[model samples]
Target chain A: MVLRRFLPALPPLLAFAGILAIWELLSLYFGLDGLPPPSVALRQVPVILTDPQSLFDIVDSLRRMAIGIVLALVFAIPVGLWMGRSRFAAAFFNPLLSVIYPVPKAALMPIIMLWLGVGDASKILVIFLGVTLPLIYHSYQGSRAVEEKLLWSAAAMGMQPPARLARIVLPAALPEILVGCRTALVLGLITMVTSEMIARQTGIGNLVFQSLEMGIYDTVYAMIVIIGALGFILDVLFERLRGWLVGWAEPAQSIIVGST
Target chain B: MIRFRQKQRSFTFERGFRLERGLALAFAIAASTAGLTAASAQTIPTIRVGWTVPAEDAKYWMMKRPQEFPNLGKKYNVEWVQFQGTAQMVQAMAAGALDCSTQGVLSLAQGAASAGLQTYIVAQHVGEKAPESFSVYWAVKDDSPIKSVKDFKGKTIGLNVLGTGIWGPLAIALKKNGIDPDKDVKLVEAAFPTQEDAIRTGRLDVGVLNQPFAARAEAKGGLRKVFAISEEIPDIVHILEACSKTFVDKNPELAALYVQDLTAGMGKALANRDETLKIVTEIFKAPVAVFDPFYFKTRASSDAPLGSADFARDPGAAANYDGIQKMFKLYYDVGMLPKQLDVKDFKHAKIFAPLKP
Candidate 1:
């Protein structure tokens, strides 16, 4: 049972190891100065883990990303449900969303910085802007796609509007909303790195940029590894949450076609 | 008449083919010779000079037009590399990807801060004297009641960056005024251009601005200078022309000549205003009007010494080594420099003498 539980993680672990092997080979083959290989990263592992400031920077970045995502969810869900369920709400919001959503949120940095002031508010807002649109779009689509037959049956069963929304609309929309949340999670990390670099000087971005300045390229690489590992952990945790939330939404397998 | 008619005559098919073949042979020979010359030229070591973007690399700009450095092209097959910031230039120098840069003192200190930086300053860009020296201003919004650094005890301030040309002196100046550089004031890292907006929006109490940008802010009419960085440190040179140690050690005479070449170009800018503005306008892609106040400020200062007479031309000309040490010590005290480096370890100034007018 333990082996079976562990088996699912083997491929990702092997893939990571394979990438490290390749990185080591590249560093050796190219004789790249400043770009130390995986072994150096391993050596610095103790250093990174022990430094309180470095640990704090990592935690701070993660906290900002989480806050941004939560803010997006909090703001997007109600508006998205309204837009999805009501024609007037959809008409008012959809055009505006379409116009704003396609615009790269990063380009709005100076304006965002001006609006939110500099520090975590600006950085978090940048992430929130990036995360919100997809959440709104997917949640709207998921709610809109709920079956008319179910709505009729619920109406016949004397379900009020609020009851229908809570019991019927929300649960039916969970799978697509989870998909949007997954996408936003990835975007949250990207925007977090970007916003940190632009507005504030105290995150993984600062570490990477400053390390490059100090000619500590190994530290830059090390910070990148930390970012990647954090991203991977977040992805795994998210996927588990997604599975639990929408277990009924399993994808249909493709039919085998050839001689078999 | 017969020769003219023959020259103007249309070619027959036989003659056209023969002529084409003959021309092709000549073209191939000429192309081969040109390619060979180019390949040979590549073997000549180029002095890759780095210049930070958004103007202010006046010496680098001086080299761009022959009016600046007459024989720069003759002495060195020059290539100008553009960097977004001092840190990038320092990295390039450390990697040996760049040879020289007209680096700011903060960036130069940063290069020194790095354990592996192989760069050295050959000459000063501007000596620490009023009018001629670099101008860094601490400004507040016009309506702001905060008078000085003392007023900034609990106030928020804008910095271009923590470790840059602006911050190096700003930090020291703030500390000298009895304010703890770190704890007394809240610091926000914002771009110099946008810091004006920050101050206007009441987001920042004080904004530290570098020249040209500061001039623009002053022109915008709502900000007033509270203090000047140069006033705080009268002897601090703002910028220096620096080259890699590898370049200097191997070609000592070349390095000296490089400084001389730069001085000749930059010296012209110091002596003549209108002509220099014309060139500056072109190099910066800015208008003469924008440079009017900036030029006026520079002229009023009236201490533009084209050649810095402050330090020895070369480390061998060690008559004024103490001055150099004092400069290094100032940066160290300011905490701009991370390492407690000895001046002698890096100061080999005797190799680069300023070009005499």
Candidate 2:
């Protein structure tokens, strides 16, 4: 029945509506001493949008993230694939990554500031470091999972060595490699915001941080909303691109891409 | 024919779609509920307070110094955090991780006004007529032509946090000197401690300085003192002892005790300047002279109650409301406060309730 189809969509919509209502109630009642209400926070959307500087901050964040992600991908994929495909390579590097991966990138910010002098390089490098481990780990797994049959067949067909790799191994691992890239991109963004918040003097993190310090919780919330919306839009766009590139693969293959 | 087939044919597609939508809906509802519940649970009974004063300087308040701070045990459960700079310390305060802290009057007023936190004046300390109060100094190479605040018009100037400390004061000074703070000068905001290196490489024309670093800079290249906020605008440099109203409301007696102990400590420190200088120097890891000139005369008044009663009786006392109110206005006129908040609304006086004074 038409009712059955409609009922399925009703819960999420109702739940979100309930959430907004509660948020409004909290803004009205449990206000943090002198902070503005949710209405004011909502109104700031247009104000932030109209302000050119807000846009600049967003663009700056994106620019930094792009540079960091690109660097991470360039370094992670080949290195990860080499390490994953070769046991000797994995043994040599795995211990190093294992030792360093769990250490918070944020804790190293001051040292980075000292060595790199608190410029964009330090920020970008921090972002790059944050993403590189996950990127390498994911790519290594993806490379390891490349079907052995396909490589054997390519070899049996007597294809040229480079051609065999290009025609067989790369394509077989393409979906998983893209998955690594997606994780790296997300990690890069997290680091971008964290790095900016912890030190540096610019970007969305700085904007939110400055607002918080000044007791402009509305602006802080507004910046957070912007960051969330930006992340959502990015995830959607990446999903669409993944679908276009690899929809023929199983839905399971696309799950990681969608989550990112 | 179509009706019969529709009834007979399995509703597989519809069922799949319904299941997917149902899962998404459930997830959304669950997530919101979980997030709200978790957030509510995280709200603890006690308030957290942070200080930029090193652990050693604050050791008197720690449990280790049981005699000095009887207030530190499980009765109050005060959480003390430490930071390296006023910028970060105040930042933590804004995040609600700190209920009270000591910072430069300029930064404190700006932060309190903007954040809507009630900033009560607990104490005020004054430094001498020096170019720096509590900041590190920036000095150019010996050959640099920048001689004073006037020469800084077309040159790069290193500053600490722009709104909080030296930035606003420096801006006010520059505007008074017929130089636009923004258009005429390139203001580079580096952390207070690192400006020395930035200056060493000829990156800045006039480097902002606080005592010991200024003294250090003078030793390095014999730099000139262009301007001091305390000098340009006297009494603009008061150390504010402030906390949020939520904190005061929850822990009135505890808050009063905090004020009492801190004021007592300030009194002791002031009376014994040379020894206090040694202690503060060790705490800050800066030279003794860095703290020497800025150290104000602390009045040993155990009877001076907390809040307005203490200030009302001694209007010109070490931490009077009228003087702090004036400094707060200075911060407002310079566009540091987000909007004009009546300074009176900020005063929450209960300092006399606990103390017999």
Chain A TM-score, each candidate: 0.85, 0.85
For the predicted complex of model 1, DockQ is 0.01
Q: Give the clashing residue pairs of candidate 2, or none.
A: A215-B115, B135-B210, B137-B209, B138-B207, B306-B351
Worst 10 residues of 1 chain B by lDDT: B309-318
DockQ for all models, in order? 0.01, 0.02
Docking class of 1: incorrect
- Per-candidate TM equals 0.48, 0.48
User: Per-prediction count of colliding residue pairs?
Assistant: 7, 5
Off by over 4 Å in 1: A1-260, B1-40, B53-58, B67-70, B131-134, B176-178, B296-324
Candidate 2 lDDT score relative to the true structure? 0.58
> How would you encode candidate 1's per-residue C-alpha lDDT over A1-260 as one tens digit per residue?
99999999999899999999999998887544355788886666567668776777677777677777877877886677767899998999989998998888877765665455444677778889999999998889988988877778889999998877656766677677778888999999988887765434356665555454333446667878878878889999889766645544656344444433
lDDT of 2 by residue, A217-259 (tens): 5777777767777877888787775554444453432122323
